[model samples]
Target: MRIDRTALTDLAQGAAFLGSGGGGDPYYSLLLGQAELARVESFELVPLDSLGDDALVVPCGWIGAPTVSVEKLPSGLEALAGLKRLERELGRPIDAVLPIEIGGGNGLAPLVSAARLGVPVVDADGMGRAFPESQMAIFNIRGLSACPSVLTAACGALTVIETDDNLTHERIARGLSVALGGIAHMVEYPLTGREAKDHAIGGSVSAAIAIGAAVRRAREGGDDPFAALYAALRDTSLYPYAGELFDGKIVDLERETQGGFSVGRVVIEGFGGSGRMELVFQNENLIARRDGDVVAMVPDLITVMDRETADSITTERLKYGQRVKIVGAAAPAMLREARALALVGPGAFGFTDAYRPIEALNGWDQG
Candidate 1:
């Protein structure tokens, strides 16, 4: 299978939806992917069945805060640097560049790396949506290790983490990210095409393009983009429920800016007996609760959007009186398994109960 120009938008949009409210903006990644596509010509659909068991596949992504990616901008050398470093350490040529997670800026960064490195991009990815930590990838459930992982912060801070366990890698990377000023650039978890096919979210890159296309068509037709998005996602059967529609004004936003990550939360007051909602975010909205009850949690997509426009608002860009809609959607079934749940469910982020599928929590009435 080959990804054409029209398919790129579908991938980007689906990724944004899957990003579950914190994968960074898809527009930037789309532009980046488009540029790379123009240079590379076309992306080959490397199916999982095509590779041998030991085909070398490396996951690539931008590590810092999404806000930093917008302001500071990557010179584009950092990912290549990390890729080269990892290849040297492993003493093998990386056969393909795999997307770490779909959504946000990280999704497109790998395309550039693939084009520059002249390697194919595996059709699958570690996470279907953007995840905050490095070790949250489904690969962990498959018993694959994160270390021997290589991290390269854009500012010339390079480190090779050799952890005995996946949890340790997440801990160490989080600290390093904090020390790096809240965000860093990294490439890790070298795997093979066969392993990638078995472990990663299958066809996620292609799915991103398909979702982006559906949204683009809606826009072109001058129709409702959100409704069109909902229709497109039906192809995936991911979100089975929608969360409460909260009308709130941002009363307070406390952010800790460091190492490129702006970790913070936005407090909002319910309108006309609607109650209150607090959104906790670390680069992405992780948990949301109303009246002290968890309404949405990780492994599911919780997005804060302009109530009217439906456009996403970044954690750092949120401000006072910005009317927003808090949306909760069910996570992908591939990620909803017991193993995946343990890593990304409500408890993984310190919430109490296991994350209930959005469909189970709420009716599927997104029309």
Candidate 2:
């Protein structure tokens, strides 16, 4: 499928929601994509099954503090440089590129690479939603190596990482991102078509676009955008369950860029003394509590969005006085499995509570 300008705009909106309050704002990537669209008519998105068995699939995106992404400007060559280097290292022409995770701005990172490299963007991603650490990616969770990966900075520096351990790869990449001024594009977990088909989150790109389009249409027709959003999510095979978690005014926030990530917590005061909700984070939102009761946690997406517009407010963009709605969606089925949860579940973030479905916890009918 060809993604034209309008679909690209829809994609940004959808991807922003998927970020779960991290992944940096898709606004910047949307601008970059629009600029790229001016030179290339449209970007091509191919389904995962379309690739040949031997096709080389590379997943790429930016990593670092979301706060820094708001301030740093890209030189527009990060993905291009990293992708070109990966092709050289592997001794073959790259067949396709996909986002390492499809959340916030990172979701669209591959489109720029696709336009520059003249390759199609695969409609799949390593992580169904954005995660703070590289090892949390489904690729790594599936026991894949993140080696021979390229980390490119906006200032003309490129480093290739080769490690047997995915955790070490994340550490090196995180350190490099901080050194390069808090953010860098990464090309990692290069996969064969078979690997991608077996492990990657399929149809996510189209899912994001569909979500954005649904919201856009609702707003245009004077319908409730949130309703449209819920319907869109339920319609997708990836995120089957969705609901509005909370609606309130942000009253207290303790956010700061720390240890190469946006680490902090936020408090949202409910209207008319309905109690308050507190959320903890490390780049992406990790957990949510309503009146001190655990309502949602990692592996389940928790996003903060503008109450009226329903546009996502990335972690760096969350402010103390904004009226916003908290949205929760179940992670893709694959991420909820036992093996996948060990890396992305609440325990992974030090929370003792076990993984629970968003629908079960919220009392929303999945029917």
* Highest-scoring model, TM-score: 2
Model 1 compared with the native: what TM-score?
Answer: 0.87
For 1-367, candidate 2 gives per-residue lDDT tens digits of 9999999999999999998988889988999899999999999999999999999999999999989988998888999999999999999999999999999899997998888999999999988899999999998889888988999999999999999999999999999999999999999999999999999999999999999999999999999999999999999999988988899999999988888999999999999989899999999998999999888888999999899999999999988899999999989999999999999999998889988888889987545
What does candidate 1's lDDT look like per residue over 1-367, in tens digits? 6665666656665666566655566676678778777776766667556777887888878665666656665555777888888889889988888888876656666777877888777777888777877778888867898878877765788888898798888778767866765566677788876678778887777766666676677778888766765565667644445444466777778877654456788888876757888988877788877877776677777777676655666665678888887766666778888888887777887767767666555545445
User: What do the candidate models score in CA lDDT, each in turn?
Assistant: 0.72, 0.93
- TM-scores vs. true structure, each candidate: 0.87, 0.99
Worst 10 residues of 2 by lDDT: 358-367
Question: Listing every candidate in turn, what is its Cα RMSD in Å to the true structure after a full C-alpha superposition?
Answer: 3.0, 0.8
Tell me the lDDT of model 1 at 261: 58
Score candidate 1 by lDDT. Answer: 0.72
